[model samples]
Target: MTNNQPAPDGVLRLINGYWATGVIGAASAHSLFTHLENGADTAAKLAARAEISERGTQTLLDGLVGVGLVQLHEGRYRNGPEASAYLVEGKPASLTSFAQLKLKHMGGLVALPDVVRAGGPVTDPTTEVADNPHWEEVVPAIAAQSVPAATLAAEVLGLAGAGPISILDVGGGSGIYSAVWLEANPQARATQLDWAPINAIARRLLVERGVADRFTSVDGDFHTTDFGTAQYDVALYSHIAHQEGPENNIAVLARLRQALRPGGALVICDYVVDDDRGGPAFPLIFAAEMLLKSKQGGTWRRCDYHDWLLKAGFEDVSFHSAPPATLVVAR
Candidate 1:
C-alpha cells in the first residue's frame, strides 16, 4: 500500500470524508436541531422528547456540534444560527419543507448503488407522492415553500412588458410562481393547473394573497388535460420539465405554444448544465436523484431548452442565469 491517505490529490482526497450526508440526515431525523425550536434542552430531555435512548441522542448531538449544526453549552444543546433559520418549523424563512423533501429522497443514496449496477432509470419510491391526498392538503405549504424562488420569477415578469396579463402556470404546485407574480404586478392574473391536492392549496394561497378573484384553478393530470390554447399572454414552466424528461418537455412546450396567443411568451425555469459537461454541483447531484426517482427527467443543457423551444414552434429564445438554474424566455 502506498499510503493512500496521502495519495496524489493531497489534501483534496482526504478532505472529502463521505459521512457528511449521513451525519446531517441523522441530526435532522432525530430532530436534534429543530427540537430546540422552543428552547435549548439537555440531551436527556431531548432524547426523552424524541423517544430515543439518551446515550445515542447525546452522541449524535456531539457530532452535530462538531459539524456546526448544533451548539453545546454548559449542559444543554441548541440549534446553531444557520439551523435556527432554515431548519426550525414555523419560522419566517423556514426551508424545512425542502429539507423534508431531501430527507424523503435520501433513500436514493443507497438506491444509486443498485442504479449504477443496472445502468438505467431507477424505480422512484416517491412517485406516489403525486397521488397522495395529503399532497393536495399541503399544497399551500408547498407553494409557500417556493416563495423565495417565485419572488425572483415575479420580478422578471414585471420587467418583461406592460399589459393586463394572463399567465398560465403548468404543473403549478403551491402556485408560488403565479402567486408571487400576481403579488408583484397587481394587473396580472393566472390560471393554475396541477393535481387536485396542489390545486386546493393554490386556491387558499391565492385567496390569502388577495389574488383569488383573478386566479383560476384547474385540477387534473397535465398529460391529458387541456391547457387553454392561444389564450394567455404568458405561460410558466418552473422546475417541472426535468421531472418528465426531454420528450415530454418538448411535447409540453408544443402544447403550451398552442395555448399562447400570437407573439405571447413562454418562461421556463430549470437548472442548466454547462455545454462543456462540467460542474455546477447542484444540478449534477439533482440529476443523479432524478435517475433514481424519475422516468424521463434530468438536468438538461441550455441548448436543450433553446432547441426544444424552437422545435416546439417558438422563436427568439432568451436565456438568463439564476443561481443553480437558468430562466428561458421565448416567443
Candidate 2:
C-alpha cells in the first residue's frame, strides 16, 4: 500500500453503483419527487405526505441530494431540475414508471453470470416469456426513456412541417416517435406495427396524447407482418436493431427500404459502437445487458450498420449523434 495513493475511488463507485439506482428508484416509488414538486419541502412534511418514516424520509432525501437528483437549501429539500421534470408521476415525459420497472430488472441481473455461462439467458426475454413477460412494462417505460432520442430524430429529419407525410413505425413500442412526430406535424399520420397487446398500450397512450385519430395500429410481429411497398414517406426502426442478429436486422432493413416511398428515408435508432469497438461507455456497457437478455443481441459497430443497410439495398447511409443513442438514416 502506498501512502500517497490509498483509495480506489472510481472502482469503489462502480462497485457500489447499485446504490444510486436503488435510491433513485425508491424515491420515485415513494412519490418523493412528486411530493417535493408539490411543495412538501421539509423532511417531516414529505414523510407525512408520502407516508414514509421521518428518518427514512430524511435519509432518502439526503441520498437524493447526494445523487444530484434533489437539491438542499436551508434544511429544506426539493427536486433537482431533472427530477422535477421526469420523475414526477403524472407528467407526459415522466419516467416514474420506468424507474419502478427497472427495479424489477435489477434482480434478473443476478443471473448474468449464469446467462453468460449458458451463452445467453436460459430463456431469452426476446422469446416472449409468458411466465414473466416484461415487454408490457418495458414498452411504456422505454417510451419515456426514449423521449430525447425520438425527439432528436424528428428534428434531424425535419419532421416538423414536413407536410402530409406517412410514417411506418415497425416495432414501435409505445408509438412515442409517432406521437412526437404527429404532434409536431399536424398533416402527418402514423401506422404502428407491434403485438396486439403492445399496440393496445400504444393506442391508449396515443389516445391520451389526443392523436389516436390519425394513428393506426397493425397488431402483429414485425418479422412476420407485411410492411407493404412504397407506402410510407418515413419508416422508423428505433431501438430494435440491437435486439437482433446481423442477418435479422439486414432483412428487416430491406423490408423497411421497400416500404419507403421513392425518395423517402428509413431512420434507425440504436446504441451503435464505433467500428474499432473502442469506447463511449454506455453503449459498450449496454451490450452486456443485451447479452444477458437475448440471444445474438449486442451493440454493433458503425461499419456493421453501414454494411447491413447497404446490403438491404439502401444506397446512402449516415450516422448522427443523438446523445445516449445514435441514428442511422438510409435513403
**Model 2 misplaced stretches (Cα beyond 4 Å):** 1-6, 124-133
Which candidate leads the pack in TM-score? Answer: 2
User: How badly does each model clash, as a count of residue pairs?
Assistant: 5, 0
Relative to the unseen true structure, what is the C-alpha lDDT of residue 194 in candidate 1, on a scale of 0 to 100? 87
**Each candidate's TM vs. the true structure?**
0.76, 0.94
The lDDT leader among the candidates is: 2
lDDT of 2 by residue, 1-331 (tens): 5978867987887888888888888888899999999999999999999998999989888888877899998888878888988999888679988888777778878888888888887873654532335667777887887778788888888999699999999989888989998898999999999888788889988998889999999988899899999999999999889989999999999999999999899999999898898967789999988878778879999999999988999998889987678989989
Off by over 4 Å in 1: 1-85, 91-93, 121-130, 134-145, 159-163
Q: Please write out the lDDT profile of model 1 over residues 7-49, one tens digit for every residue.
A: 5554653354334455566666666667776664788888887
True-vs-predicted CA distance for residue 242, candidate 2, Å:
0.7
